[model samples]
Target: MPIATIILAAGASTRLGGQPKQLLTHNGKTLIRQIADAALSLQSGPVIAILGSNYEQIQPELADLPLQVVLNPNWPEGMASSLKFGLKALIDEPVDAFLVVLTDQPYVTTDLLQELITTQQQTGRGIVACRYGEAGHLGVPALFDIRYGSEFMQLSGDIGARKLIKQYAGDCAEIPFPLAAIDLDTWQDVEAWSKRQGAGFEDQGTQPKS
Candidate 1:
């Protein structure tokens, strides 16, 4: 099945003192590029990276990648705005399912995403979501069958794809992704994550555009 993936890089990164987590360097590429490349690596279908806040600066990171770039003017409204916009862009495309990706999840890999797709195909489930492997947390990088396209558009506020995963739990399959629990939401988070990886990061004083 052709699967379209959306990389959510639209956040203002408020917790990181106005830094754009999407632009943060990981290994060699920016977090956004890493995640975008992971999606593209699948060669499944179109990949979309939603930008907002510091979109002007973030856009170039994804310019060379073969994926759709969407800027969310209402990104401040939260994840829901970006989610809805990305979903709208592909809801009518020839895709069997949608996989929502997050830039902050440093460990999300192509294999992991494939696992979600594989599980969905094997179980014949409509949704395939990740379990943080902690407290049974179910969230994105989640996959939703095209049947949930309308629900994706109706999301509002900061709520994201996780809401749909929870709402339709019975129809969902779970993949154990303890690494999904490690997200870069704050300066401390970045510091801790980098330190754990034997790397260091200096807050570059990057300001948000939104």
Candidate 2:
């Protein structure tokens, strides 16, 4: 069974003062590139990125990578739109499962992704989420069996896969990942988190100094 990855990089970043957060630099590469590289490294299946907002600017950044790019014109509506667009593109592909990830999670690694994939395959569950923080927070960077692809496409509003996971909690499994909780949303958030991680602004390859 092949595992495909769908990276949602179409958000408006309204809370980040309208900047394309995925284009923000981190450790000598754009956040989106870092995420794409990590996902590609973990799984051999087709990797698709859903782009919107400043698509033109971000498109160039991913040109050299081996990834399929899909545009979400309805991205302004919210995350669900991007999710639907990506899933629609893969409707004809031979994918056995999917790992839905967000570009904002710079801390996500190939190892963590492989773990989720392995766990889902072993447990035979329809959904598996990464558990973050000491309290075991759950979010995206989740894996879903093809059995629930229809339910995934039915997702609406701004709510993500969490709604479906909640609907089928009895069959969902959570993997602890405290680092997944750290994500860049604002300049301040970027600096504060980088500082805590000892990742100076220079390490992020950004023009601005923290």
lDDT of each: 0.86, 0.83
List model 2 lDDT by residue over 50-145, tens digit each: 999989878988899888999999987778888888889889989998999998878888988999988987898888998786666577789988
By summed lDDT, which 10 consecutive residues of candidate 2 come out lowest? 201-210
- Give the RMSD in angstroms, all C-alphas superposed, for model 1: 2.7
Candidate 1 local Cα displacement, residue 154, angstroms: 1.5
**Candidate 1, pairs of clashing residues:** none
Q: Give one digit per residue, the lDDT tens place, for model 1 in 1-210.
A: 899998888888888767788888855678888898889999999898899999888898888877899989999898999988888889568998889999999999999999999999899999999998568799989999988988878888988888888899999999888888899897778878888999865433453333
Give candidate 2 misplaced runs (Cα > 4 Å).
202-210
Count of clashes, each model: 0, 1
Residue 169 in model 2: shift from native, Å? 0.8
TM-score, prediction 2: 0.92
- lDDT of candidate model 1 versus the reference: 0.86
Clashing pairs in 2: 27-204
